[model samples]
Target: MWRWILERLDEQFPAFDVDRWWGIDDPFERMIGSVLVQNTTWSNAAKALAGLRERSWLTPQALGSLSADDLIPAIRSAGFQQAKSRTILRLVHWLMQHGGVGGIIERQATTEQLRSELLSLKGIGEETADTILAYSFNRPTISGDAYARRLYQRVSGESLRYKQIRHAILDEIKTWADLARLHGLIVEHGKVICRKRSPRCEGCQLRPRCLFFDHAKRLS
Candidate 1:
């Protein structure tokens, strides 16, 4: 299935490229950005993250000293400023209490354990946990978002629960690189061609292998 889809994508979009999404190199930056990106565009999240960084409050240690209200303006661009600010400050306190963000990552906890711990935090969810696990720690977790869900439904003709879908996708892909590349590709694809309301499958790279496209063609 993996090879089939990859071949189809390559054939249809010869110049198709998945951008490397590791913009914030530090694990702490990635972790904070991952949480801040919830229900927001990357541009907004980037702006907020940059705001925090500019004030040198991007670190857990710095955030530990700051109150939630004090952090609101820096992350206001990401929306839900107060709620997210509270969440971020709480996370900072937790990290500081545990020795710091570096201490948390340095634990090298198993993926499951780490995800559980993250979810235990106030605002962190499965998507945020998986994002931190995969992007921050280079763990092999299929980060299932709208992009991945839509791509899966289009290509496989299946409605899947989040965990089930992510697990299934991981099973099909060969390596961590494949998972990472596919995640980025589908995200870009979702933003560009494979929209929710009306996907542009006519000239899309995955149309050749997409179940929806094939079904439509057969009906016609």
Candidate 2:
């Protein structure tokens, strides 16, 4: 079922690309975007990221050196400006303490160890940690965002916890590329088709196997 869903989503959204979705190529930049995008849309996050880049403050050392007040203006577009600024500062400090991005990337820590370290920080959570692990560190882990949860529940007709969903999907994904593509595909499908309100079920390829669609059809 997982493979089927992945294959169908790939066919549906042929141009889906995870790196493009985050609008960053550098692993560190991807980490920054992931944090900035926490409670805002990608468009807003992109603006904040652009602001950082324009000021040459995109690096850990540059950002860590700035006061939160200075960082806030640049990231105002992302909303929650004050809090996000503090979070970013804390993240940069944490990264520096852990031997900076290069050191952490080269460290022998296991995925779980890295995840624990990230979660110990102020704004980092399961999703963010997994995203850093998968995208930044090239680990075979799923980010398990809201889209993945909603789609998985609709398809399976059961609500599962984030860890449960991550484990289930991780079991099937063999490589880093597969993990990245699956996360991108699920998010794209949710935004384009299985949205929160009035999902486009009429011509959706997954309708035949979608429990939510079948139930809605019976009700109608």
Candidate 3:
């Protein structure tokens, strides 16, 4: 069913070019974005990214050198400036300690093992850790974010726990690229159709397979 949804999403949003999903192809930028987009829109996060890039603070070294106060103004667009700045600092320092994203990927080898360590970090929650693992480090793990949970709930008729949903998607996805693509497609679906309020279900390709739609139709 997850694969069914992914395939439909791929069809619905035909312009999902994995190579151009913001700066996801770049590990450093993705890490920054993962932090910046904690509870904000990607557009706002992009503004923060642009601010950081303008000052050459995109790199772990450059960003790590700055104090939280130094970063607050630059990432204010993303909101939660105080906390996110500290998080970015911790994340960059951690990355540097681990010899960067590539080094962690090569050294860890197992997503679960590395995920545990990442979860221990100050700002890295389950979703953020999974996102970094899947996109930054190029591992085949599900992010299990709000978008993912919402999509799964609408399609399957009920909400599974985060672990269940992540495991289900992980089972369906085989490669890191597919994992990234699945995240991208689901996020696009969330923003464009499966919105938090007043979802545009009439034109959604997945409506036929969506249990929520079926339930709504019955109620109507």
Q: TM-scores of the models, in the given order? A: 0.86, 0.93, 0.92
What TM-score number comes out for model 3? 0.92
Identify the superior model by TM-score, candidate 1 or candidate 3.
3
lDDT of 3 by residue, 1-220 (tens): 8778878888998888866865446878988998898998888999999999999989988988889999999999999999999988988888899898767867945878888888888988998888888778877888788888998888887788888888888887788887788898888889889999999999898998888898889999
Q: Which regions of candidate 3 are displaced past 4 Å?
A: none
Question: Global lDDT of each model?
Answer: 0.77, 0.87, 0.86
State residue 202's C-alpha deviation in candidate 3, in Å. 2.5
* lDDT agreement of model 1 with the native: 0.77
Is 1 or 2 the stronger prediction by lDDT?
A: 2
Better of 2 and 3 by lDDT: 2
lDDT at 60, model 3: 86
User: How many backbone collisions does model 1 have?
Assistant: 0
lDDT of 2 by residue, 1-220 (tens): 7778888888888888887776678988888888888888989999999999999999998998899999999999999899888888888898899888788889998888988988998888899889888888888788767898899889879888898889888888778898888898888889989998999988687887999999999999
Name the best candidate (by TM-score): 2
The collision pairs in model 1 are: none
Model 1 C-alpha lDDT per residue in residues 91-200, reported as the tens digit of each score: 66766776665676687677788788778998988888888777766677767777777788888998777897788777877566667666776676787788887788
Candidate 2, residue 134: the lDDT equals: 88
